[model samples]
Target: MSHSSSDDEDTDISESEISEYEDKKYGELRNGVQNVKTSNENGTFICPYCPRKRKQDYLYKELLQHASGVGQSSSKKRKARDKANHLALVKYLEKDLMDVDVPAKDSKPTDESDPSVNSHEQFVWPWIGIVVNIPTRRTVDGRCFGESGSRLRDEYRSRGFNPVRVNGLWNHRGHSGTALVEFSKDWQGLQNALEFERAYELDHHGKKDWFANSEQKSGLYGWVARADDYKMNNIYGEHLQTMGDVQTISELIEEEARRQDKLVSNLTNIIEVKNQHLKEIEMRCHETTHKMDLVMMEKDKLVEAYNAATKKIQSTAMDMLKKISIDHEKLKLELESQKNELELRKIELENREAHNESERNRLEQEIRENAMKNTSLHMATLEHKKADENVMKLAEDQRRQKEQLHAKILHLQKQLDMKQELELEIQRLKGSLNVLKYMENDDDGADVLKKVDSLQKDLRDKEESLEDLGELNQTLITKERLSNDELQEARQALINGVKKLSSLGNIRLKRMGELDTRPFFEAIKKRHKQKEVEDRVLEMCSLWEEHLTNPDWHPFKVIMAEGKEKEIIDDDDEKLKKLKKEWGEGPYKAVVQALLEINEYNPSGRYVTTIVWNYKEGRRATLKEGVQLLLNQWKKMKKVSS
Candidate 1:
């Protein structure tokens, strides 16, 4: 029924506008992501909603809250409110974590009837309090913050922090500002609260006693978690039956165990995942290292190409700028030339206007002279000729002359108008030229700006690439360090294993087991030169010992006719010094001389046995010398007979 209702609700709320909202949200997210991407383009600003920005926000929230007021809850109501908020936050987090589109079910409600009565109670008892002394002195000697415990208490209270104080002042009447603190009950709660509040700064007087130093700063510090246990026992009379039922404790223990197991499992999983991630990181490091080699090669090539490109671009830009400068200079020169031409044209036009005015004055003077002479002559002729004929001819002639003058005036006016129009056209052309020059300058400026933009963009791209490479290098270094540590550990382990194996081999060798001489000889032969002296020594010893052991291996020998033992001896300063140092000049010297004489011989004839004996052997024996002594002594001695 719940599922059907949920489906119905979902159907009712399935609106198309929600999809648009989602799309808009997605677009915003994409835009944010894009902003976070290394902005190679110049003048681009990062969006405020970037992941990096979000991370900073999150960090500020977490750290600031931890550093400030959220940690200062004391009253029950405040604590409960805080816990509820915490629970709501936890639920929000869980909801985000789960992402399951389902509503949670409500569990059964417990009793809501009475406020005072306990449904089940084992016992009731009055709150007991204990007063403990915490001195303001250091016990090592007498150094402290120079404050009495009471003064410290007052300071704490003034600071709006409450601290438990002992009744009356500790250490009797000498101490002032002592306070008595009252407690309702004794438990871990009071201790926790006290410890939390005890660390603040305090203002007081007097030095601490250093002679009775304790681990705690208060020289005579002591505390107990509970002081009511003995009283409860006394009241209960040794063995009163508890009424709360054992199941409660059992359930608590079980719940605690389950929680612990879950914690352990989670921790183990976390460790395993972390280890796996470490391994993956190692593998990635290897891959990256390999790729880095290739990347380095490619990077080198790219750097070469980029450098070459940059060099070319720089050369080109310099060339372009040089051309632009030249062009600008040329444009300025052209503008100056145009200004000079315009000035010259204006001067020429002024001169032309002055000449035209002078010509007009000359023409006016000729016309005035002609009119005066004609007027005088016309009056004299008017009286002399036939009046009708003369008057008609004179009128006709006057009309024709007036018409000609009018035509000349009209022609001059048209010439003046044409000159004005020509001047106006010249001015328009000059203005057009100026406009063209400005447009050319604007084009040049725009081109230079574009080049600057391009350069800036390239620089930004290179910088971003460099930063990425740097971050990658750092990550690589971290991975390399981890690998190197692991490898070093492994190498040490291998070395230890080798040492153990060598130790085992030494133990085996020390057990007096026979060695395979054939293999030993083969190894020596293969590894050492045939003419090596050690090989010759071994061969000679083996041959001599074999020959001496065989009963049938007797050889001819010569001796001093009446042979008593005769030993040859030689000495040098070194031997004398050694003998002098090793033994005192007494009977010990004679024994040493005899031994030295025996050791210093080279025998010529031999059919010998050798016997080595300790000096403690009581037999009257002659210690022979040289190879002959060695063989003869050995021949004379038997293992059982000796």
Candidate 2:
């Protein structure tokens, strides 16, 4: 039923059939959006009524889409106020962004007499403020301008504006509502004064951070525009002329400077436009040169055709002379015909020369025009070089501003990410809280309590090991990057082992293993390139690497043969059978080096194998046990020697 009502409401509010209130609302929004778009360099917009997370940082188009959707939505949950805001947004988007056919209002002409453009004098720099729709200044004997400037100053000063002088105007009988205020020369005072431009009366009363929203309902509302007091200069000059005022001297000089600055700015704009036109003229000159080349090619073709025609006419004349010699009576008539043809040819040649003369005159004119354009282009290029320095200065300023904005955005993004992470953690804690409540209310609460108690006892009993584990964790954290790399390497090795269909972990053989040479013999049967012992070792290692599958084969007995260390089969009397039985039929092999270490200071010396095998399983205590065993044997030997 709610959905049906929402749909009905959506159908009822046709876009073209909005009421007076909505039309006024939409008009105000359109104006606001236009002003904002003019001022805003970045095309980022946001829904004003949305929650903080959803409201910030939307591109212009995305905001438009959102506005369109929410304005015309059939959702039952949308509030009437929210719908009004979104509809205003839709109106702004369509009229200002989509249609884009509306003409802008005419801007006021530049006021050359405004003193702020060039004045740098202390306490005399001009800054104007306009206040409108204010209540009349009331006195004991009714409305009057008795110290009205002081009252206005105190009133505005309480609300973040600090105007130095305020002139409250009056009607014929009483003080009026209009006041012209003067502000300080500093930029901050101007900024504070400008902030009052769009503020209504109620906005000044309480809404300190309010926007110029037309929907705000208030009685006797006032708004103002910040404007330059150009006529103030003329008023001062007139006062100086009549009343012997000394302030007009500096004021006139400042006004003249402002006028000069405006003139220079206009001249610079004209020069920039002239430079653009010169470049266009240069392009036209290039096009004219191309056309001249085509005309020359046409002239060359015409000259060739004329030469061919001349040869034909000469041959015809030769033939006619021969005919004249053959018949005397016919000769006269043929001669007249030949003379008529020559006259026609001469007239055609004269017409061609006249056309050539006209063409040459036109080409010469174009050449002169092109030369003039080249001179103008050179002058424009020199002027453009001057403009480039100013443009470069502006570009540098914009670049610095862009970098500041980028840093601010990065800081904001980091804060946003941190806020999101904290929110997620809070949600997780809430979920944990719910789980704890469920556990407390569960029917198996007693069993859970017992399990907790048993776990606590176990924790206490294993406190020392827990401390050791924590130390190890701290070690890993200290060298986290290196530890992570070593872990990944181990994981990759295990994956490689699995891919070869071998043991995932190194398996310890009960006895030392020997090379099962039967497969090796079969493999190297067709090979007979064993020249040096080095060659034999290379061939053996290659064969071992290529054919070996399991990774547990760490055969490392290497000895000197033919001036190179060579692997040999150790077939000692007691271990031969055991070596043959252990790794005889394994599908794995490897070639590695091993050596024995003997301690010279020991009472009873024994050689220990120094073999390095990659072990993934964490059985580290075994190394300590082996060392302890060695120490005990050394002590026994020492006791016997004593």
Candidate 3:
């Protein structure tokens, strides 16, 4: 019967709890006491169950009601939410663990007594375990011992774990060399360390054991509560250890609270002392305020005095301004008069400037013309000097040739006289030889034979000498013929040079005449008929022909003529056809024939005579116009070709 009642009571309580949960709104429970005011400047009452405050104006009963209602509702909702989240996390962890494929050997159970294996499957408090190998001698110094612990702590942290404590154990013997490290309670950090270990194993596959047998070992090992430990220990061992640590932490917190209370008491004493100092300062400030009032009174009196002085000075300045205004008016009138005079002077200066500019332009044109004339004269002078030098050189050559010829003639005459004397001696010897032959019949025949032998030998020697002389004379004659040819050539060259000089001189004189007659021809153009105009044009054409035909004409003129011919032939073929149309084919053909004949004599003469005749009246202007006409005709032909 008692068991039945207990079961009924449990049923009743469960029904009541279910009813309460159903009746309460989830949004209201989560938000908590929406209508209750929590902020006020007045003294406040702090809620014990949560971090909520209310003004003192709130009734004690209302405050209690809020605490019992909304506070309980929030707590219950939070517990339910936390339970659901925990279940979800557990399911996720199970899925991850099942998916992971750990090696059979690595997953095998380790020794139960090994402290390196973490027995706890879930962490209630933040605590990680780590073991590190540290040489005993290195831990002899306190700093080295700290460094070893720090190194172990850093190794865990480097793998994304937060170490809370690092403890190093050292001994005199080298055998006891170990460090312990604790990390913050973070499941992600634990998972990362496990993942790192797994990756390290895979990366070093087929090699020596990465964790235990490496020559350059990291000397580190980490264990976390979330890690799957192969060894089994007492299931509640970590809970008991955590409880004990919590008890020790509570004691430490109480001690710290007592120390904080002592610090608060000390601060209160300091505050009280500072309050007394503040009171003294306030008293001094009041005294200073009283003195400031007196100073303000004095400042007001001085300001009134200053205002009076300012008023007097302002009056004086007003008088001075009036005088200055009058002076300004007078000065403005004077400036106006001066401006008027300046404008007149400027106009006069402008007129003078215009005259000066025109004069300068005229002077510059005259200077340019003079410079051209001077250049032509200088070239002509150079040609004259060259001609004189050539003439002197030719005369020297002629004189030398005449001297050589005279010497040769004298040598030949001497040779002829010697030959005559030898011939006469030969005749006399022959006569004596005949006389000796007659004597040979008488008894002196041997003597006569000896004499005749000597005479014959002498004749042979003489005849050999004569043969040598004859060869020499033949060579001399050949040399004389060569000299005569060379001399004739020199004389011809001299004559040609003389003719060239005379022609250049004639061209210069003719050019001067053209310059002199240019204005006269321009003046006569008004009254001249086409025939007269044609005659004048012919005269000009003849002058140009003579100039172009002269071999010694100025090099510049020759170049100009060659350029004109090339420009016409290459650029103005159509202009030649146009002339055929205007002047008739017969006259055009005649003109062309004349031009070709002139070109044969001197290449520069082509088109020279025509250009001179066409441009004689207008001189430079007509020449430019004719050139433009030719260029236009060439352009039209090019367009047609395209």
User: How many residue pairs collide in each prediction?
Assistant: 19, 0, 0
Off by over 4 Å in 2: 1-83, 86-277, 297-301, 314-318, 324-642
Candidate order by decreasing lDDT: 2, 3, 1
Residue 365: error of model 3 in Å?
Answer: 3.5
State the lDDT at 26 in candidate 3.
Answer: 28
lDDT for position 305 in model 2:
82
Name the lDDT value of residue 527 in candidate 3.
56
List runs of model 1 lying over 4 Å from the truth.
1-187, 190-254, 295-642
Model 1 Cα lDDT, one tens digit per residue, 546-586: 53334452332334556665433323334434534543344
lDDT of candidate model 1 versus the reference: 0.39
Cand. 3 TM to true fold: 0.18
Model 3, position 72, has a per-residue lDDT of 36
Over 1-642, each residue of candidate 2 has an lDDT whose tens digit, in order, gives 011123444343433444443555566665553232423456666565464454565666677778768876878777554566577666666444532121123422224355533233222224455554555556777755533667878877887777766766555556655566666433444455545544443356322322356465433232222112222443322222221112232464455568568878999998789667656655665665566567657756865786577568656755765564455435445555655655565455445533577886865665566556555655655565566556556656755775686567556555544444344334343333333333553589887566556555554545544454456456658799787788656544533333343233442111112333444443344344545544554566455434222334323356999999865544442333342454342212222111111111111222221221235452222333333444565687799999
Output the number of the lDDT-best candidate.
Answer: 2
Q: Which has the higher TM-score value, candidate number 1 or candidate number 3?
A: 3
